[model samples]
Target: MQETPFCLTFGHILPYSMSDSNTTDFTNPSTFILLGIPGLEKAHVWISIPFCAMYAIAVLGNFTILFIVMIEKSLHGPMYYFLCMLAVTDLVLSTSILPKMLSIFWFNSREINFSACLTQMYFIHCFSGMESGIFLAMALDRYVAICDPLRHSTILTNSVVCKIGLAVVLRGSILVLPFPFLVRRWPYCRTNIIPHSFCEHMAVVKLACSDIRVSSYYSLSVAFCLISLDVFFITVSYIQILRAIFSLRRRDARLKTFGTCGSHLCVILAFYIPILFSFLTHRFGQNVALHFHVLMANAYLLVPPMINPIIYGVRTKQIRDKLLRLFTDKGT
Candidate 1:
């Protein structure tokens, strides 16, 4: 959305207007402006280059993972099943924001319809929550495999993995479905200039003329309840996995066990560190530059999708070998 100097609010007189309450009729605007990046207006042209590159890599990388896992019979298991789900979620999350963001940078098309914005907001949050859930599932997969190797196959069968994937999607969608409706019901009297790249929940909620305590609290509650819970379980799983590794009598076996977790640990850090930073910076970093906060917010969205495949490709021998063989076969 394009930024404007002024916006009209209901039941309030326009400054320097001669008309009184009897003469004024308030009309709610049909569209909102997404201010792409605060204070980086001049660099938008340069910014789009790297943004486009990252988007391209994220799509290609994630798609490769999905393709390999789907066709390679060797990789058909609970772990790879969850990885495939992660690739899908990353694709959705990246696609949800990057194209519109690019439009703003390239064509200066910043106007998004109110309904469209809410839809975008819903998908962004839902996909993110789903990714978090998928991470938790991966953690559980690793926990069962390492901590209880004998029962791993029995515990997480193909049917069970499918059920877990379906449950993750449904849980995320159900929890995030209310966010758009909550924002849509509010009367937006302030400037609809969202000071970030996308229709992030809090940024959009802050524009409401009415008290936003309910929406704010609800959003915070969901973040903590869902994201935090996912992180907690993942941490617990890793801890148990570590304990299991240490209990191994053979050094080679211990290293191999830790090696199995290496890729996941890289991915877990890549996904969560930026998220935690963005969450804290958005809430408590008033003294920090708004543009920096906005940049970090964009980073949180963009970085994980871009890096996940790289981490997997490098650290995951099956994926790495498949990628090499695929390319080599193509070359020959």
Candidate 2:
């Protein structure tokens, strides 16, 4: 939607008047333009190649993990159930961004309606919080298996796992549900170009014409509080697990115990470090390049989905052997 420029004669000089019918009003809906990776116009084509590849791998890998876990009776335990949930979250998170991203990158289709933009923002943030919750749940599962091996089964029964899953969903939904409603109430009278690949909370809020103090403060508080709590619990769980491992007399016992948690640790580090860096850079680093911030935000979304399954497949022998056997059977 291009604006038509015109000039009006006043007293001494003629003033420029531009007609922008698409510009939003306080009473009506408007569309937003998503500018994917500012200052990278020349590299959009090259950048999208790797993004497409990673998205494909994430979809294939996570679905493979889900299928294997569902079909294998041995993998029907609590740990694997948590893994399945993680895969589902990764799939949802990846799908929420990639299709729109590819459309923007490849087709230059960047105009999104207001309601649609808010929906994307809501789900992306919601699923991200859910992933953090799932990580905490996985941490607890490992802690129980390692620190209280005798009661692991009793503590994490099917009913308990279902409850944990429901709690994760509710925690994420309750915290993130207010964001879209807040944004909807804001009158966006300025330019609606969001300088990011997706509809991020801050990026969208920055487009508002009204005061956004509450939106900013509340969103920041919710994010930090949730992430801090999850990380705190995960840290405590790992600390106790390490203590339990150290108490074992045999080296083999200690090695085997730590091995069970290695894949999860790899995933946690991969997921959290980039996310924390992205958020910190966006909120605090005034001198950071726009392209760098955009890249990090995207990595925070895409990298974990692409790498989690690979980590589990490579490190967990049960998954590895099952995958190999499945491939072998398909060939035969």
Candidate 3:
């Protein structure tokens, strides 16, 4: 008699047949099983509490940022426009992963259709690239505003901002367009069980029967090229900005100028540090715990979106003041 196939569910082994009509194929799965943090299976419910809270905060905060930016005409500038773009990108990025993640954790719905997995992977990566580009644009906005204050208005007009936004979108979309296609072509003749809560590209690719060097190399190249170039440009822009700020005659002017960059700096650190850590962990941390890598990956998506609005709201004088007045009027 043929042995029955089994799968792990909430720390219990259950008979899971691959031959069932509704089930995924063993050779080339039509659906993949997400393990939802392998070692921490029993704690998925507890884990999801914080994840759910973060998702809620991300949604509410990003929408709030969008609403504030839209209503406050005074914020109709290059920096705020880039911020709105960032907010939208964060929303998409977090939303792409969190809902399904929660479903897996809370309901034990580990099965994700193949095409849907690719869609999730695409959105997550695409918006992540877009976020990076937006950060570069925002850095440039600050650079121009501080270094060439006189021409700031002329240099980053509404038309120019729109074009920059378009460029960011196009660059991200075009580059990431290949990822799903590449992954789809791979033969997943290995197991369909992915030890992750979401369809992370490498996680899915690892299950392919064929050699994944092309997919791996492509992903690494894209990440390195995008991040390295963006970081270099942002560094250059900030160096110029710092020079301009220090060259100012008045100490108060320097302080005020630096203050303008504080929120952006915080946001940049919040976004990049976790993501870089997660990337390195995924690529090189072979001995690292699987749960650690999974947690970090989720954190990069969740933490930034949740904190970005708070960073802007608290650090930006105009936004803070506007929020206060809006709430105060409501309280009356």
The candidate that wins on lDDT is: 3
Model 3 agreement with the true structure over 1-332: per-residue lDDT tens digits: 31112122212322233434434334456788887887788898999999989989989988988999999999988999999999999999998998899898889898999999999999989999999999999999999989898999999999999999999999999888899998898776535777788998888877776677788889988897677789889999999999999999999989999999999999999999999999988768867877798899999989999999999999999889989999999999
**Tens digits of per-residue lDDT for model 2, 113-150:** 88999999999999999999999999999999998989
* C-alpha-based local distance difference test score of model 3: 0.86
Worst window of 10 by summed lDDT in candidate 2: 3-12
lDDT of 1 by residue, 155-228 (tens): 99999999999999998999999999888887765366666778888888776667777887889989987899
Q: Global lDDT of each model?
A: 0.83, 0.85, 0.86
**TM-score (C-alpha) between model 2 and the true structure:** 0.92
- What is the C-alpha local distance difference test score of candidate 2? 0.85
Q: Candidate 3 at residue 285, lDDT?
A: 85
lDDT of 1 at 321: 94
Ranking 1 against 2 by lDDT, winner:
2
Q: Each model's TM-score, in the order given? A: 0.91, 0.92, 0.92
| Candidate 1 pairs with clashing backbones | 1-33, 1-34, 1-110
